[model samples]
Target chain A: MSDSDFSILGGPPSERNDESSGGNRTARDDRDTDADPTPELPPGDAATALHRARLYSLLALGLERPDGNGGLEMDDTTALVNAAAALDRTVEDAATAVDDHLTDTAERKKRWASLFGVEEGHTVSPYELTYLPGPLLTTVRQLADIRGFYHAFGIDVGEKMPYRGDHVCYQLEFLAHLCLRDARLRRAGDDEGVTIVVDARRTFLEAHLGRWFWRFAGEISAHDDGFFAAVADLLAALVEDEIAILDLDPEWVPDTSEVTEWNEGIFGAAGRSCGGCGADATGLEDLEGSPGNPRNPGSQTAQDGLDDR
Target chain B: MPQVHNWQLNREVEFPYEESRPERQWAAMFDLNKCIECQTCTLACKTTWTHEEGQEHMFWNNVETKPYGAHPIGWDKRTLEDMGTMEWDGDTYEGDTIFETEDVDWDDPENHPTEERINEDVAGFMPDIEDDWRYPNLGEDETAGEEMDLDVHFDEDTHPIWFFYLPRICNHCTYAGCAGGCPVQAIYKRPEDGVVLIDREECQAQMVCNETCPYKKAQYNPAETISQKCVGCYPKTEDGRAPQCFETCLGKIRLHGYINTPEEADDSDPMAEPTNPLDFLVHQKEVALPLYPQFGLEPNVYYIPPTTAPVDYLEQLFGPGVEDAFETYRAIGDGEEPALEGLLNLMGSTEWSITAFEVDDGEAVGYYEGDEVGRVPITEPQTERDRVDEVDGEEVYRLDIT
Candidate 1:
């Protein structure tokens, strides 16, 4: 493997010290680089963090609503396949399934529309709160909390993309953003910055995205065992891997699926109603350059996602 | 124990910390008579500061309907019970304060709190997370005394059964109980404005402040494993702007400014020169009284005791100043205290903090750092209309005319 391609799996120092950038390493060869590495694996942690970030970004882009252009490009698929192979067999298998199921652009677009889009009334919901239980008044706090995480990092939603902060795409993108920060901070040799970003990522996953992602995967898989299903599987596999890596135990959402009333008796159906796009009176505002700071997208100087600080 | 002068008690009170005062104390006054308990202040505070996962139950600004309503149910009643029977000898508190109740010598080196051990001797009960914080507005709108009867006639101050809205926030006391009781000394009063805050980094999650604060403003965040409380909206106050809760008050019941003690009180009346409005209302007019002065924390926030509530109940809550405060409040309506009336009128007129104020040529003018921020009429304009008016050769009775 290239010096930049770090193995995500926990491997021995001897194996990591071997300066081979080959992606065809066995499961036993590619173990955790997240833990404290030997002197030989100094760049491995940074590379691995960036690697995980790329995969997360790919998954986020794949799940988001199609922007007229056909979603999930072949190059992205190739990258995903390579990244997944580096992580574990299960993820690689899921990524291969996604690659195999890549259909025609028009067909893929139509499938995405019917499943996650409004065509089928979002048959497979990509919103985190969809799987969660309780009244909107009670649960809407999570929505605020999600926005708070974004705000704390000075991340705001783009004006054009009005998706809710709790959207699967946004959550995945947030994770990607955190991982990117982790990589950047690691490269800069800022341990404190790395700790903060990593801790934020762990807590955020436990509190928000991690809690409801498996349910989303289940919903998507139950609906159709096709391209979207494979994508869902990829998502599930990546998240499961991360959960294992982080040693997190997220609180799962309820089993039953029910779309709550638009108003939920809060605004009495009089004021502006929620359009299931995370835009409501009590919902998140358009955060301008959310998920990550667009101004300094890649530049990390120890203060990643700590703009407030 | 370190003895500090508590002006509200008009006596020296025992405290854990030495007498170290901020440059200026952050304080606000709420006219209980004008409060509607709309919860706008509560929501504003919630959205501004405490909308996180663990802070779901927290309301930094809560308007509880007293004599029965309380957030975290019986927060005041239970603390008072623990304090036992506190008496007011004239203006001096005759009973033990919250710090003095347990009789733990805070001056002793052994009693000093560290990260390892909690100061269990702090005189207050630790509220259960689930049971105490479950209901934010328990007994909402519930009244006390005799039940209301349809045939019974009552006036503004003559109601047999009564309830008044009591909006609460962090008192940001001169001798802050949270700051005093913190094991690791995580909680501190800002040297600039006296805004008490729990240092998130320094906090060891001992949760001592949660139990020690008599007002129960200090809250534990389970998600972050730290104790949190009102930061007194120091960010806004730093820029000479009112806090979110103060600005969002719909009834115009809140007046935000810095307060001074009676000895250091501002005497510039504002007619000739700029005068501190908070000092004028809290000290000069003596219309507003601190809530539970006998607690001995020397809380900064003051309240104009509700005219409708019973004198005895008001006395217990606001100490012996309730009757005098009510008298001064009534005198303003009777046009006896013109300057006080003008200053009260200036409240809630602007979002900018009123550092100084003046009554000038039939108008109440508010100022922030010598610049005029708000101006309102001392008396709202009124006009008398004729009973009958001729409209297109037809007589029209002006029934709704003032």
Candidate 2:
């Protein structure tokens, strides 16, 4: 895929300009202000493509609580609302909540902390690896595979981005990046390139995001009914629509219901309780204490003391 | 009822099944001293057989740190407490077998344990969806005694605290508790290899096999509504290959082979016909002992007791031979005794079943199907290492090892 395809931020083929100028041009000089307007894809394809791109961008930005520095300006909020309306009316209320004062930078940060847990026990993890079954601390393979997908397209998680490669925000951002690439490929009439990009996006969706999105969305919906809940609905809907668009075999994808059940067995009410206080514990924090949580000193101590003889 | 001589117990015990002995009983030995709890064996077994949807919590092979680790959470302690403190007079154990311990009669297939037959003192446990279900790492790395300081060396003869990994799998016992407990005779031991398996079609989800098996290896799959356990990787073994766990063991601590029963071997000299490595360890040199032999299950799986763990604890677990086993293991590991050295070498000789083996030139050469397959050295070959500058401002170091 071309570099422009993966760029979520709209830009020209800067690599081509760099090669022509021997990399001596200023950032502004590389701008394609006078470039010709590209032909659009077919109506159905163009609308689906645009909707997917906008949805991904909105979900990516929305999942990460707004940073006070600058994020999701008026135009972005309008775009998100318009995109949500275009996709389905069910998400319209949630779309409007995107611009609510309660979602302001500081308030959103607090909400983020409450929703996606701060350290260990209290929050729902946004990490895809956490939802899978296996021993914790051996999550390298899954994380590496996700990183490989990003690296294959010359994308890297910025040092400033506070999320791991498997985090929902980063995953959504990756999908948005792929959608943007798909749009560029289609516009350029590079059918082969479009096919390759679409296939990659479909694989990513079926394997990673689509596999776990519903369970994650369920968790969010369970906790909230406003902005995030709406975002969750939008996410689930978008994934389903994408699966249909790509003509991917639904049978090949893992059933999210089964995954939800398995996850609940590990992190739900019937699962292991806090060894110290006997309170219901979920996530790694409750099992292994989160730093500075006085309720749990360390789960290792409790485990050690569980001698029946 | 059938009676079989259990050499570990030094007495014949009653078995519920008839005298239908296999042509060659499958046996294995685990060297605790070499295991590092890497979970390679566990993962290998998991990915091979138990990756299905319902088998998520099942670990056919699990390595847990003693005295606080167990896959089913308190499997050993609960069973031990239920059986009560066994009487050991030196090397001889005077204890009731699983059949003799309770009031239930073994001869009658309908005579299974009711709620009343279970001792009230011992906590009744079922592998439920709650605390007991998903605790594979519940007590992992929780060693006995105080945590030693960083300055304390592990090589020291005596340490304040220590823990060792105990890798466990289905023992495929001669008198399996699951087989005896099954009222429908759903759980059976194959006459060919003596590998015990639960017949899915015959199993009615009575969970008697799950409750009766002291080791708790038989797991209930709610989705399938049948209990399952390790099949001893029979498909691989049938083709003269080692099981997945044994083949993938990173520590090379596992040895799998066929062993003759007490009746089949020459009683006057048990080591006379020693062929495979397990025969040398279990029957001849007597370096490995079955786990919890006092339970009178005649478990085919044997263990070379951990050298570092406390003697009293080891004795309680592996019976009176723990000290002797440890001594023999240490001697074999150090290559002090040639016979023991040969046995250790043969343990890692090949991936295929070694029918006959001999120690030659400090290497254990193994033969399968009347042809030599591989040889393993008593000690691994040392690698040569050197560092040199290859170009201006560039340096590279290379070491040759596999």
Candidate 3:
């Protein structure tokens, strides 16, 4: 961490030491007109692009901190809004790929359905279970929220924006209001792919598979030996790739496996620390870097040492 | 969207909103002074709302250590990624946002692979001491999944008792980032009571809210294909009742009540000043305290710091180490002498302490309680972050000035 990263929000730090690069007091001044000057990618490397996209996306979320007046620079804000719009196309494309791959191989599709526990029967669809209210309503409400965004900067989404059914595509169009996601949607609002895939997912989870899934998955894992675990690992890897391409953190993408882990840990907390711990645990005296543990990720050199005296 | 919070107490309105209409518009206050981190609230929520498959990893209610934050790895530290604070351009406020990213795959259960239990070699039995324990398996060897648990459960770390739990739930903020960030419009705040909720019907399981939220409170439900969080128990509060977590709370630290509009802050009612939702939560009512007011999300949960620790320790957490400053923070936390003095002067020079919380001017004032007399300017934000440092091998007391 650099001195630039220092800024107290609320409460005191958990530990304290003397590492003052530049001690400065700043009054709250809320306005983000300046633009980020970081260098862009040199050329076209999809993986690099993907990685940058991921980091930038994480940064976008971080910008929500109260320090900069609860807002972001106009450039960064537009970039993120645009990214959201573009991701919808990826969603549509992925859904389309899965649906298209399903048509030619009935046996494969059937096996895929059976393996994943898809009880809705074999079908070529994008699924609507992923959006909200209804497929059409997802676009409507999302658009409603973005309306404030447009009004803030005097941008327009044209007439097709309002009352549109394709939220993902419309999201791409909404990016046109800024500039980032504008290129992803082919600049149109016509797509039936994701709407279908998400719907089926909703149906299966809410009605059929939602119940006993945890226990079933658990029992299967315990009995898997290794083959099923390998297959599960492959599927997770594929999905992880998809998420990375979308420039998202694992947490950002909703995955049941991760959520389940969180649920168990949270439940076990016994509601401790809900009211805040009052102990002023002293910061252990500044220790130097450890050469003994090659595995230690936190061992920093003197740069890690902050002298308090 | 950039509206600042108002903390003045307003008395005109009543609390424990109505369910049918979701009309409580009430705020909760947590007395940090009384919190013991029993995590009763966390379990209370899990047993009631998120025991299902997909929600297994989510803690709709958690009380993590501040500076160090919950979920999404280092969320508090990540805030620096935005401004020049983290290694951006320079030392100047250039504005930033909790900018929205891709809409989360709200119902994408395939990507989430699970094992019977945690892999001992990966997440490990003791996480705190190991430091790199992968509770969520964030960063680990590719083959870590090869090892699975043969035991009945995982082991819990034993942190020191000095810690405070910031019992958390959905803030149901008036201007909620989760709701605003949802590409599917799945997360929405009830207009009736201002309790934020996930319209599971509208949510497709795209965890956009998960990314966009600075707090990362919006959780994924694996089995249901939806996201869920505290609706402030609007369903219960609307009916003049506290939510299950609050009702079942072993500590009983949560206070559910409504505040009049900030416009009426000057009126006899409480709940004014710090008009923004966050300031309202952190001060005055003295219920919950801001986990890290510096990171913008502007949470509505407030905490009343416990009195068990030294007055100096409490002073540092709030502001100012002077004698009067100590007295002031204590007074507001007392739940008797009106709003805390630190909360009042910190925000503005307003003498009206009721229904208000002051943050900025909470520096030192006079001598007492074995502390130095006279006031000193509150510590700078940079020093606050410096409070925590990783120990290296070598000589002790090296000042880090990167």
Which numbered prediction scores highest in lDDT against the true structure? 1
Could you give the CAPRI-style class of model 1? incorrect
Clashing pairs in 2: A5-A181, A117-A123
The 10-residue segment with the lowest total lDDT in model 2 chain A: A1-10
| Residue-level lDDT tens digits of model 2 in A97-210 | 665633556666666667875633545668887666543323345677788899988899988876778998888888888778877777777766666667668778877887
Clashes of each: 12, 2, 131
TM-score of each: 0.64, 0.57, 0.37
Candidate 3 chain B least-lDDT 10 residues? B118-127
Ordered from best to worst TM-score, the candidate numbers read 1, 2, 3
- Between candidates 1 and 2, the lDDT winner: 1
> What TM-score does prediction 1 earn?
0.64
Which runs of model 3 end up more than 4 angstroms from their true locations? A1-309, B1-24, B66-69, B80-162, B266-289, B306-326, B332-402
Instruction: Estimate, for each residue in A1-309, the C-alpha lDDT of model 3 and write its tens digit.
Output: 111121121111221132452221111111232333333222223333343343233232221222333222335434433443444444334323322332223343334343333375322111212322222312233334444444544555456324332222222222222222222222233123222222322222333223222233343344443323222222233233334443333212123312122223334442222211212112211111111233322221111211110
Task: Please provide, for model 2 over B127-155, each residue's C-alpha lDDT reduced to its tens digit, 9 standing for 90 to 100.
Answer: 55444556675556766655677876766
Candidate 3: C-alpha RMSD after superposition? 26.9
How much does each candidate deviate from the true structure in C-alpha RMSD? 17.0, 18.2, 26.9
Q: How does each model score on lDDT?
A: 0.76, 0.66, 0.36
lDDT of 3 by residue, B52-90 (tens): 445545667765433222333444333333322211122
**What is the C-alpha local distance difference test score of candidate 1?**
0.76
Interface RMSD values for all candidates: 24.1, 23.3, 20.0
